[model samples]
Target: MRAGVRNLLNIRTRRVSLAPPGLPRAFDGFSILLLSDMHLGSIPELGPAVVRVIEGLRADVCVFAGDFRLYAHQSGPTFETDLRRIVDAVRAPAGLYGVLGNHDTIDDARLADCLGIRMLVNEAVSIRRDGATIRLAGVDDPHTYRLDDLDRALAGAPKGAFTVLAAHTSEIAADAAHKGVGLYLCGHTHGGQICLPGGVPLLVSTRSPRAYACGEWDLRGMKGYTSAGVGASIVPARFNCPGEVVTIEMRAKSSRTRPARTSCP
Candidate 1:
């Protein structure tokens, strides 16, 4: 257990691809930095480690999957200070987007807004590049709060424009797929937080399928990737599942594809 606690700083950068069919040519090579479940105050020192990794990386867009603070309804100077530090270190030219997790509150959303993270609570935003636009829709925390409205979040998306839904948990995956979503990005289980060998998880907290609880998964052709996350929850420790900062490259492909591959650095 002590070793697992010390492994909290072993934050690896996992690289994968998101090549959902019908992706616009403009976004063929778009890169996204996915950060999630950063229960910040759980381990104070984890902040600088994350910042260091962010400083050395760049992405077209950065998405925070939520759980900014360690506990729900708990915020203080330390949490705010650490949150600001981590957000300020991001290097996404397109923008920083986020959704709230079970551990976050409305005030936490407001705090993220103050830090320039566009919190998409039951809303959507469009990202344009070279005359092509892709929609990013995010919902509220669906694990504990269950306040997400998929229709409201995806209301204005055009007929066939590729849409990516960012929820804190993958519980809404089936609904999103039914609604024509092309890609889904989320992180809530922390990859079990304490896994056995080969990174096999002992428990994935969400009620979603165990398949969608960790890495890349396909639900009826819609692609999704659940981050292992950058910080711990429940306790500041990790086992075989080292926390991760995921970088995903979006490609234009058909044929019900899987990610191009995963590389570690």
Candidate 2:
């Protein structure tokens, strides 16, 4: 999942197949759209950019992990407007699901309600499509408001249902894998905004250093891709890393083996 930012600019509306080779016949690929950290108040243009991406991609489900707005002390209609623009632009394939990120203040709560987004606050919702049942769960921003209880979020889920977990932090993958999640989508690291010599980020605002950083990584029992995020943070500059909206095609992994494959944003 760690690729040069220059490579992501080449991303267009096309099927970049991610189905691992040697997949069993039991499952077909699941189409998923992943976008995070738009920071709408900071980068207003990001809303339309994301809408265009949404229009271009043909997907089964879409996930916006978190950080809808930049931190604003004077929260009011203007802040709500910024949040509304971003949320309204998001056209989820199935539905728009989200959590809050640290930069997002109390304004996020009202925005979540106003935008009609299905805010998942440490809870899960089950939905069915094409005869497949999926368990979707999301947690609040762990930084300012942490209510991440993987067990509680996933309680009573059907034993065989496909599970997707969305969070703002990539570290949640460790717990997600232990909870038997099939996929986890997160965006906190801006793909190492200032990439280092080996494409590593110099500074990160996340609670924990990004282990997965930006791009795909496989945990013990789960697989996921972390978006570099659409907007900026802190200094608002990107070097070797370009922001991205990740499109992932998920095929069920076999219990017997992990297939070798290559993926991009």
Candidate 3:
């Protein structure tokens, strides 16, 4: 009973809307369901809850920001089974994409492929809808096992195409902005994994500014969000910081006007 209560209290869905400059009219109102830092092996029971939440949400695409496992070396068949089940439950017409996180092994790619997730390791792909195109890029983990290659990730993106990048850590927000990436999505901090009252994080583990630790932030001309994550790490308990799945709605800004820049409260 206590476990069930904790699951109910700790997990939630957060909805966010963004209108980045230069978003294509064809892709306006596009919605993406973003999930990160699942840490499946660490909190096994969280899987069913995550699956339920994702299956209930509506999205044009679904993107995972990695850390699918807790202990890299210890992740085994159990982890794969839980991950596959969660992945299968997600529904998106545009498709599903993911990147590797610090806690995941290279072999996790096979599991992702089997589950119909395209693992993007420092790569980019373009998706089209209703005669409009947007580029989606992903880089490897930028935290512990750093292997991120921002240049290569954006290499295939066409000039002036609206681009979104999926990275494990918000530390790359600045670089992504400089490269003209319109939006950057990430999750790894877990909002300190524990916190003070009113969801104030005590210690954010990223190299980025504390302002970018969790929630949305504007980095120069780009927009970025660091999710609190869907599972806990280090310990199976969260204080004021609850686990979450984020839904980002994309709207197109008028061609003659610039989009307003905003930061997380």
lDDT of each: 0.88, 0.64, 0.83
Over the stretch 1-265, how does candidate 2's per-residue lDDT look in tens digits?
2233233332233232343333233435666667677666444444555566655555666677787765545222344565566556655557767777777765576668667777787888886766667788987776556766777788888776667888888767777777678777788876766676566677666665466766667777577767777766664455666667666776655434334443322
**Per-residue lDDT of model 3, residues 26-62, tens digit only:** 8877888999988887655667778887878878899
Sort by lDDT, best first. Answer: 1, 3, 2
* Residue 114 lDDT, candidate 3, scale 0-100: 77
Give lDDT: candidate 3, residue 182.
94
Best by lDDT: 1
Per-candidate count of clashing residue pairs (backbone under 3 Å): 0, 1, 0
Candidate 3 overall lDDT versus native: 0.83
Model 1 lDDT per residue over 144-190, tens place: 99999999999988899789889999999999999889899999999
lDDT of 1 at 72: 89
Candidate 1, residue 171: the lDDT equals 97
| Candidate 2, residue 62: how far the Cα is off, in Å | 1.7
Candidate 2 steric clashes: 1
